[model samples]
Target: MVVTATRTALASADVLADVSVVDAETLARSGAVSLADVLVHLPGVEMTRNGGPLGTTNLYLRGGNTNHTVVMIDGIRIDTQSGSGGATCQAIPVGQIERIEILRGPAAAVYGSDAVAGVVQVFTKGGQDGFTPSVGVGVGSQGTRTLTAGVRGAEAGWRYALALGRETSEGYNIQPAAYPDRDGYERNTASLRLGKDLAPGHRLDATWVYSDADAGYDSTTSKSSANYAKDNRALQRLSALGLSWQAKWSDVWSTRVMVTRADDRYATLPAPGAVPSYNTQTQVDTVLLHNRWNWREAVWTAALESRQDRLSNAGTQPRDTSRTQDALALGYGAKSGAHSWQVNARLDDDSEFGQYTTGALAYGWAFAPSWRLTASVGTAFRAPTLYQRFSEYGFAGLEPEKARNREIGLKYSQQGHEFAVVAYQNRVSNLITFSGAGACASSFGCYANTARAKLQGVTLSGATHMAGVVWTASLDVQDPVDVATGKRLARRAQRLLKLGAETGWQTWGLKADLLLSGDRYDRVTDARPLLPGYGVLNLSATKALTPNWSLLLRMDNVGDKYYETARGYATAGRTAFVGLTWTGR
Candidate 1:
């Protein structure tokens, strides 16, 4: 399989860094309801949520900040510039996703800012050679219902695909202690893709995706003693559009031009006599121009990118803001005898934060026929978000957060068995954090670059297939701490374990997964009690009824364990779902 870790495509076997891929078949077999479900099983990945299904979710990769990871959908950046500068992973529908590529470790040298930890790219379903149609319906716990339909085809020199889906659930209470009412959520999604071959080696493609949701949540700002029981609702909408043209100019040269636009809008309505309603909107526009050249033993790529970010808020305190960024990147990869190497460098000039330069170098040696060793060092940075710089309690003199990273990996594979181990360390400086001391010690504190941190971790993973069954397991041990006070970073588990087994016989298939997380602190200080560790089990089964039909059943949180990823939040208990799908070709 080809991977996009280096911007230019490379074979998975030739990559010198840690990477993971989740394809459509794997997603379908897992029967996951959200993207977070699939990512938590991967090595060096952790997720924390504030509530149940529709609550705010955050992902931490290799112990980095939630905003440190960059998210992309079909070459379009989908990271939001709202409250905390992260992707809205819960709002994305898994039914429309065809594949996901995860590149672990720092990738800022090739992807620019917001890549302090790694990168996640999602690819949606594409057109096929012939006319194909599919439909699915499912009903599950908590009065949940789902419906999805899609059609894809290609003929002559044109191809097209379209998908539509909807989901609704009368969810359980997310904040039982403070709010005694049940929360409910509803969502609708649509996606479209179109492409055409202009000439022999030239093609043009366009894609668009839309999602809208309404959900009820708890409010902590009410004045009345029973105000927490009142209703508080939020409406969210997202839209992404992209257009690109790719051409193979010669046997050794290729070029591409692409443009993308994304918009995110959210509105919150509080109970009467409580906090006033507010609306926030964020929009991003990006343009990319790239070229690649191939040689006997090496490949080289260069690209130019430009982006514009805009935000608008309407409430008692209204504001409007915008910024622009221009960047250039260069990358090279080569293989000689038993050695492979890669180098990347980038320079970004932001209209707000002057200029930043980052680079990375990696080397891989195949000492033995079935053994490989790799080492890499890189630098990364995260530019200050608009909210951090211009919000009501913002600070204008914040510097960009920066980090230096180093990693070493070893891999072994033989006879359908594979094992890998990787160790990494990252030291970050000028970390931006909220402070209620020094210059801004008022009621509304301001964000300041007043902290430093160090993160180090080791991950081990292995997989084996035998006797019609496959077994996979992974373990991660990490130490992430703040340098000044020697305190563990909040919401980051120090250890994690994941195990899975899958097997098939005749027309039936079964899969089971187990995840374990270690205790973690919920705040920067030790004054707050530590959140206890927890484990979850998930089971799924699929049976094929005919050539074009199938049935799926899934059970989540089988043990019905009560746990909290974040303090004062609630999690789902044991739940089950049954679904049926039909396809035509």
Candidate 2:
């Protein structure tokens, strides 16, 4: 079948998987300021946030732990060094993004470890047929201002692109009743891509990206005033470089290989006298190889992936750790009669966790001219992170978490409209319940293992196009239960809703979005009340003044919704920004 953005990839869907594609044009129109804001509209995806731009946040899929999710950029895996399994979306700004693909549901059979929750893959813009340059600036509510500029296209036998952008905002409060000011943040990002056609059958590409942020954090509780405590400043810096090569031997065979390295550092300070401080640095090296072959009756793909991670921390105490993992996999897919079938198997070896083998089977059948049905089942596992197994403050020896997932979905596509619905369930084993801060109080306290958990959910997502405009909607409902205690998993939202619409013309663009989530518990132990159901609106517009120049305006949280998130932590209030851009080709 011909694959398009509107057509869901069914092979991954059977085990209760769903995926959404957001192209460059849509990314620009969403006025998403950040990666978190951009992904909020995806079905079955939610965010956990704390107070401040640099605060910790995790992506929750079907009520899975944040560490369960895996993020990839241009085929390069990006994860924290501490093996905390948490990926900070704030590390990369939205303006540099070309497109984002969200693969929902369980992905362990394909990606190994962290794929237990889902996979988010991002592709950056590269050289085009010609050279182009653009720049823009904008200002808005909350003392917000933004500046961006970029150049893309090709030159000689080599294609190249570069972008530089900055965002700054005056502070806001974590809550209306609290005095501790929140919000003030400054971000600088730079990205580059270079590619060359080496020969008739070979190509080479290189990419580099760097981002830095200086932001304030609310150290006190919701009721604390800004005057009583100093504004806590936090910083996150990330730099990555990658190279890839691909070659085609013939019409039936092809090969691709890549190598990538990344370094990330995080730190937080309170005015200067704070006794407690947090700082960590991590580095990772990854290599991947993929080969594909085609036959009259079947097609096959095989891959080998490996990575090494090193982490170090310094403050009151010093720590060091390292980990390495390798995976080999093969897949076979064939078309017969009116149905397409796919089977895959993989084996993983980790220095820390022995080895694991996984497999999946899927089938897709056409029910009608414009309708299709798909079903799949897969198993995934996540090895324990260094922090989870050996931390200075609280040490725990935990086994890897395992999950089995199954899913079925339906899809319809015609003209410029598409619709899809998916239902999935994931059962987890060996859930780790660390000692809560207040549980038994202090250093002597120890944590208990929950043993097992289950999460089930259904997601309905669709998009329609009319008069050069696209409207998208998604709703997710998940019921997660603790199999051991028969209680609900804390912080797992029962309902997640996202809706958005956008229109783009040769010289004009406009968009709006809304996000809401049901109430969730804060701490797993006490189950404290965190955020309530809330909704927010965002809007943006762009107008091309000339072939190389454009004007832009953006407003975030336009409705000024006041709601807590991530354990009742204060969030950014409504804000706005304006910018201009110049492009050359």
Candidate 3:
């Protein structure tokens, strides 16, 4: 289902945006433990982690800033409000997700604000047709262990699903050069979803998810502190709750109302005899109301949304602050013979940033039976984060970051093969950067709108099935640079390539993935050395012993290549995992 692109349920082929969908079955077969693992292979996507497993992870979509992307879980925004204005991607458990939708490029016209980059929406598992229960256990390298249990089914007029999971690991040393101590991690997660059909055209649904994690990390880089060799720890908690009601007034009209709340809590403890401990908590509440009209050749959508963000921290200025936003959006799509078009517009009033407007227009032409050409232009914006405006070194007068983007795409599909190529460019203004060169220089550093940037890229992707084997490949070539200084954006590679193959015979299957990344600068400066290129290979296999039981094995980092996505950070070397599962048919 396509929801992230247009904020409506439509077929993937009908959506006028670059989108990718990953289902639960695909996640299970890939043996991916984190959301980053699955997203890293997608086109126009990049991920950077500070260290192994439980590290601070960041995602950049189509060369946009880490905070420019919006993440939603079951229609609820879960972006963090602490010092870093990014989503808690590392804290989300994969087992609880039934599907993921990734939309690339500007989406502010449909989602507003942080959709400058794109949107990633996660949907949890729902009830099945009959009573079904499952359990699984696994052991992996670094003394890792995992346990999970879940049950879901439909009974009478009600449907419900519940899942619980736990994981712990005696992780390897993250900084073996300066700090040889291992950095372990532990996590617990629970998810529940319930839905009922009140009548033929009305429904009610509710969902909740809770996650808690504790992870160990190293101190700052050696150049920054003498005690950088010491070890530190952090604890995180996340909870999300959502409720929705839907009604079908008639065959041509439908409406939906939803309310959601998300809470994020984080605490950090210094190593022995080190700095003092600190904590931060963030809460977000949102309400949405939308109506849709579907006719023979056209569809129209209108939505109203209100959201409040509250943040409390022990180290930041103001200690507590809140921001509220109200938005209205209108969209229309139509199909005329072989040509289709879509237009969307949004108006937002933010308590801190004032009024803002954004819009997008897209067109598609089916030139041939199996070929299509598409083009789009859009505008997007990102409000300054609370920490950027209210922290001890923050600048309260900063303006919102904005961008205009355009793209053209060509797609072809025939038989069991599909291919697509898209080229896009984005120009950003009022770019916010942390600098100590202006009036706030004495404050160490403060965020200011002092720079501009341009990002242009080409993405190529294709998939084909032959002789019972499916092969997929994607390549991204881009130039992301600061317009004034002509410096490359930090941590964003100029080129990325991914290749994968999957094949199964009878009850046995095998899958392999390869990723290659070009050199990139750790900092956007001419003096910093470039981080060398790297490649990694992963392999996995599964064997079905019976109709109800299966065995799985996976090997990661087969070559044990040492690499770092961020300076002074260490990544996993060679690792392996083995597991078994039982299913009730």
Residue-pair clashes per prediction, in order, are 0, 30, 0
Q: How close is candidate 3 to the true structure, as a TM-score?
A: 0.98
Q: How close is candidate 2 to the true structure, as a TM-score?
A: 0.91
lDDT, candidate 2, 418-479, per-residue tens = 88988888899977666544232246443345468888888888889877778988888888
Clashing pairs in 3: none
lDDT of 1 by residue, 127-245 (tens): 98999999999999999999999999999988989999999989888777775777888899999999999998999999898889888887762324554535778887889899999
Clashes of 3: 0
Model 1 segments beyond 4 Å from truth? 221-229, 315-318, 437-442
List clashing residue pairs in candidate 1: none
What lDDT does each candidate get?
A: 0.86, 0.74, 0.88
Give, for candidate 2, the lowest lDDT window spanning 10 residues.
1-10
RMSD to true structure for each model, in Å:
1.8, 3.6, 1.4
Worst 10 residues of 1 by lDDT: 221-230
| Candidate with the larger lDDT of 1 and 2 | 1
